[model samples]
Target: MQLRFTTDNADAAVLDVEVKELVIAGWVGRDRAAVLHHIRELEALGVPAPGAVPLFYRVATNQLSQQIRLEVVGEETSGEAEPFVFFHRGEYWVSLISDHTDRHLETFSVALSKQACIKPVAGHAWRLSEVKAHWDRLELRAWIKTNGDWITYQQGALSALLTPMDLLNRYFTDRQVEEGFAMSCGTLSAIGGIRPSSEFGMALHDPLLNRTLEHTYITGSLPVIA
Candidate 1:
């Protein structure tokens, strides 16, 4: 699927560029305890804690998804509401993505668990510059469909996570986001313990800009045939 971006020339058509690389920025938070809370939450599932602040793992461009399917039964998964940023044409564009993850595998391998699920993301995006100034005003949210009802799974201010600039500086050179590099910058905590859901909805709302980037997808679990 092609990732779309807004151009500097409002009159010009939007750019639809294929991503070259996919970067997953983990443990991205302003506070160490907050980061650890995420790590410990996973640790409760037996995933070892990382001894560091900004952890990153690379995923193939093909793992990027608009919808996702998983074949592993007993594989609990959850949608982590996060800001998706991709660099193109020497600029950064923003979108929202549900960092669909394998909770069962997390205890065995965090990276493998991350790579195990297709990353569901929105096709539309806004220019990073357009929302940088009032960045804190942006809110991130996710809802899980439980028992035929949509229940809020995650919700919080973007301010709770690390600023995009802070993340870029820690993971990239010169604090300049390179073209074709995409990162699903961290997520907010869950309302209840993480669990699987048939449907996951995510959004990035810029109240200051009075706009939002949203995406929703159905997660179909394929039979785990051994």
Candidate 2:
């Protein structure tokens, strides 16, 4: 048996993300306004709006199209820090797991320092090129049967390689994503200190990957590293 995979666009892979939690620092008298202002801006941009608490955003991505989308999903307030929680895109279906552990969800929170950290339950980061390569190796083909006419896309394949964080109009479920809004306060809370705890963020979703973290967060995905 031979399987065929497509490699039409290795440079246009997007990663989908669900917002479990977002941790941010600098909680003061003025932060309330800043948070509200930020929420308003996000809502204006089409992100799902949150209530009067911390903020959260949902994300999704497409590899071939190279687009990502983010929407606000959940919110909560820690005594010290605010945690914005969100749901995953593929949250409804059972996730494809490597270890058969049945881990279906991944969570991320922005620390008070302003760095985003992903929880361990999150899946691995997928690369467009890598997925394309896997598909191509499979040699899979799709056939369309028409009356006296036939059309086929030579180098196109959809892969289940990338894991999804947030899905839309699908199912509903919830999970704990953050340790706390503010693990630590004071000068120790710098934006630099806020980092994604999951490998998906640190290694795959690096800040310099495309100069569009905000875009990725909203859209749920980005292109492969070309």
Candidate 3:
């Protein structure tokens, strides 16, 4: 899907984003508490500040429905060791905190000058959408990594990566997904004309995809926000 950002002036920007494919440890076999404890334990061992915790956002074709926190506190070097958690926690997802400041020198900007949200659609399987209505009938699915790879389940979703301008442009431009709503998992779009939240952007954050990108990397790729 695409990365969108909303500005204070009620505008939006579309930024280039990416998601990384990783299988988290202990995803297939862990309860909710265990998962949380795992993060705590990692914190005890020191994995990183924000690195251990990933904020998740629910994405759709056009709107962001809700959000959750995916705490990543386990070991980053662990493999398949039952007790050893995976690198990709199924319960954990991440999104960038938006500031809307200028930091890039190359990229386009769109104005999402309206109030909107992000959502995904469901037909034969699951697909990301830009319309809020599409999410009305769809159920959330999660593919936590209790052990092996990401196990898709009917629980929740994970977010791809995004940047500050990315969040603004989406809200400013009012872009939408074009194709591949069936075979593919999700797509990206931009919207506009609405101000972002004080700290974050929307009311919720989470998603369903296999890619992620750092905010700095994404910002650099853009044409520089002003």
Output the number of the lDDT-best candidate. Answer: 1
Model 3 per-residue lDDT tens digits across residues 8-49: 222222222222221111112114355465446544543221
Q: Point out where model 1 deviates above 4 Å.
A: 5-9, 68-75, 174-177
TM-score, cand. 3: 0.18
User: How high is each candidate's TM-score?
Assistant: 0.90, 0.19, 0.18
Error of 3 at 93 (Å): 18
Candidate 1 at residue 31, lDDT?
81
Tell me model 2's lDDT, rounded to 2 decimals: 0.22
**Rank order (by TM-score, best first):** 1, 2, 3
Best by TM-score: 1
Model 3 spans > 4 angstroms off: 1-130, 156-226
Better of 1 and 2 by TM-score: 1
